[model samples]
Target: MTVTYLLVDGENIDATLGTSILGRRPTPEERPRWDRLLSFARDTWGQPANGLFFLNASNGLPMTFVQALRALGYTPVPLSGTEDQKVVDIAIQRTLDAIADRDDDVMLVSHDGDFLESVEGLLDGERRVGLIAFDEFRNTGFTPLKHRGLQFFDLEHDTHAFNSTLPRLRIIPIEDFDPAQFL
Candidate 1:
């Protein structure tokens, strides 16, 4: 079977879908959904595959968040750049590169449309590229790729019922960390 690689945009995922879980400091509750997402990926794609989360490297992230992701088998990679950082784009490119030499399936979980080109390249290269994002959020924007014959994977909102589920970031204390200045 071809190896599967998951490229996660942690901030994008949290900011876009976290609203569904309304509450203060909902990290604990989000954990179960997070695990479920991973489990879904594993069951759908298989385990022992690469899972990397792209995070803002310049501003630095709380060790707690990093550790939590690590515990879930996600490799947190820091991208170089501050508020002006293009790390997300770079990170996506890196994912494409990693799968260039092998026959692998690429899964990107984010609502960011900036990755359209990179995703197109993956398709052109004959690699299986799947986009995983919130269904509601995805519909809010227009995706030309969708019409251009791109395949996407929508995560079910019923993450709570998944047997292998992880917590979902329903609410985060952005005021404490000051996400605007931090990321």
Candidate 2:
């Protein structure tokens, strides 16, 4: 059996999905269904796999979220620092380096271009590197990675498995408002 490792840049993915699909940042109540995501990855890759979810410690995520991640079989690796410092990126690189010699395939879940070089190096070393991100967000930076003949899976194309029903916005007419009721 071929073991596969799924490394998720949690913040990157959450931001992209929130801005592109949800039209805003996803609230804690709108968290992705982890079981669905894991199932989708397994089906897409055609193999059993392990998942590592990297988050920014500075985000101040609640303990409940951490427990949920653990329950869903995701190992949460949190990096502490501001965004500009590239702390998460560094952690990702270190992780890649640590696992580069392993026989298992690696699937990175992020649209950040910073990983281009590391991914390219892995490909050059004969490691199968797969990128999982929203297709709509793949811009110029992603071009080089694609040019290198790496495989990519767009989450946007697979929303049925990646997103829950987003809350719809509702508008009310001025005449329907009753501000005086509170007084």
lDDT (10s digit) by residue, model 2, range 31-120: 566666666667776888788888777768667868888899888887788668777888998887777676767888888888877777
TM-score, per-candidate, Cα-based? 0.69, 0.76
TM-score: which candidate is best?
2
* Candidate 1 wrong stretches, greater than 4 Å: 18-32, 139-149, 158-183
Can you list the residue pairs that collide in candidate 2?
Answer: none
RMSD in Å for all candidates: 10.1, 9.7
Model 2 segments more than 4 A misplaced: 28-31, 59-61, 82-84, 163-183
> Please, what are the lDDT tens digits per residue for candidate 1 over residues 1-183?
776687887777666545653333335444335555566566765544567877876766777978987898888887767676678777777777767667777777777777766676666536566777755566334366666545666654433322333334433345545566437
The global Cα lDDT (0 to 1) of model 1 is 0.64
Against the true structure, whose lDDT is highest? Answer: 2
**CA lDDT, every model vs. true structure:** 0.64, 0.72
